[model samples]
Target: MTDFENVMIALPAHGHPFTNLKERSIEIIDHHQERLQTIRDASHQLIEGTVTDYMRVLFSERAWGDMAESETYAHLEHLKESGELTRASNNGIFTYTNTD
Candidate 1:
């Protein structure tokens, strides 16, 4: 079963529960944050490059980056489409400049 399924299974059934609603909600949020961090760590390894090059690194270096290739690719595309990633140079390599 999935972690969510496990969480549900472990959740209190009725009046008596392991954690209150607010605590349970916080637990869920924390779980999601950890998962997001894993994905972020994987993507953080990717530097400026063409989409093809990025794919190579994604599979080679970030194979266990905690996200599916399709999902990661979609995110990369979204960044490009959203203007979060900019062209690094004349070669069409994409690089994200951290404004923060």
Candidate 2:
């Protein structure tokens, strides 16, 4: 079997439904899209920003304000893990996009 197929077979399955998780993810992505646009619009200020810049913007926002830097970062990491968005792979900086 191909390496990709072997890896997929090794992964554990989720016994429960993921509908709520998927819905939450969609909401988070929608919110994230707006936050991303804000950061992009203020791009001039972030011309020299690193991955940290992206995290800072996200953490400071109202939607994610209740979350600590580390916490929000964890959420973003989950998105990357789920193949919803790629992290820190754009312009050598932390940028993201939908899988499509």
Candidate 3:
């Protein structure tokens, strides 16, 4: 079998692995689209808060549940890096806003 096929066979049956970094990043972004949009909407309304605050709001609204805080922050940072959002720090607290 080919090297690619061998690698695929080594992965667990229940495991999902991306072929490359770009693919993995795209999958993560797609999975969090709803949460991303919610943040975007809130940001557009001038709402700015830390990742934990956003998580609490999302959880309370039943829009997201039981996701890791770090993962949420990572996604937010990715959006910021992509220029879809803006991040600022005040007193060591990072807040986010929509770029548009």
Model 1 bad stretches (over 4 Å) = 1-19, 46-100
Q: Give stretches of model 3 more than 4 Å off.
A: 1-29, 60-67
Candidate 3 residue-wise lDDT, 8-95, digit = tens: 3233245665345444546656768877777666666556768877676556655454555676787789889999888999899899
Total residue pair clashes for candidate 3: 0
Cα deviation of 46 in candidate 3 (Å)? 5.7
In order of appearance, the predictions have TM-scores of 0.31, 0.35, 0.57
Clash pairs of candidate 2? none
lDDT per model vs. reference: 0.49, 0.52, 0.68
Instruction: Give Cα distance to truth, residue 88, candidate 1, Å.
Output: 17
Cα-lDDT of candidate 3: 0.68
Q: Which residue pairs in model 3 clash with each other? A: none
- Best by the TM-score measure: 3
Rank candidates by lDDT, best first: 3, 2, 1
lDDT of 1: 0.49
